[model samples]
Target: MNFLTIFARNLKQGPQTEAFPLGPAFTPERLRGRIEFNADHCEGCRICERVCPANAIRFAKTPDGMTFDCWHNTCVFCGNCEFYCPTDAIHQTNDWDLSHVNADKFDMVEHGLIPNQKCVECGATALNTAPVIKNAKPPLSAEEYTELRARCPKCRAKYLKNRKVPA
Candidate 1:
């Protein structure tokens, strides 16, 4: 088409683009935007940390509990953490407006307090995190259930070995 014809057609269809920052912003469905972490649902699995392509997720072990930190600036919006999280703790929301002056503000940190089960024999701490207790499988007897409660792996092994019953 000629320049005049194209110009007239364009003039007839005015403001083709959506007005953003002035009006409502539109994001596509199933868009992976930002990371939303629910500490209550988390079991300290660390699967999200291992699967993160951007290395945005960091796990810090504290005396009381562990902390999960995610930096938005480093995140590539790939939704790897959300997919890898078994507990459905990490989710990718549709809020993509992550602009910030101070980068520290974009850092989201979730702290989870996981109580270690003390070994009955040596009184040592167990390595099992939240998921172990929450997602415990059944078919275990009362004695087995009690035994699986909190003892460290080493002590649990020894305890199991001494027991007449096989776990």
Candidate 2:
């Protein structure tokens, strides 16, 4: 085909690129974009930190409790942390708009804190996270669950072991 003919065809087709900034960008359902952390659902396990290849996830001990931080700048978005989290505490969101200036680079972090709480029985300080009751044969009732959440890991284990099953 001649140049004029090709040019005419291209003009008729118009702009082939997406109208980003003016319109919303296409985000896939499974697109791994940003990291999200939920301290309430966390089991106080550091599996996500271990599985993160980029060393983006970090757990630090503070006076109040343990703090979790995921640095977006360092994160490779591999989704390893989300996959290895047993309690589904860490997951990825589809919002990929991470554009930022040089001044805001350090602020691009996902942070969460697991606050310390006193165990009802032992008075020992423990992270106020959801209790892991995987071994509980009979699902815990509302009252039982409330009691379980007030104890430390050791106390929780003992309570579960000594729980009397109703006939």
In terms of lDDT, the best-performing candidate is: 2
In terms of TM-score, the best-performing candidate is 2
TM-score of 1: 0.61
lDDT of each: 0.70, 0.91
- The ten-residue window of minimal lDDT in model 2 covers 128-137
Give stretches of model 1 more than 4 Å off.
1-14, 103-129, 132-167
lDDT of 2: 0.91
Compared with the true structure, what per-residue lDDT tens digits does model 1 show for residues 1-167? 59999899999998778879899888887888878888756667789889988888898776655767887778898988887777788889888787766756744543344454567767886544533433334345667746754567666556555656436
Model 2 residue runs over 4 Å out of place are 1-15
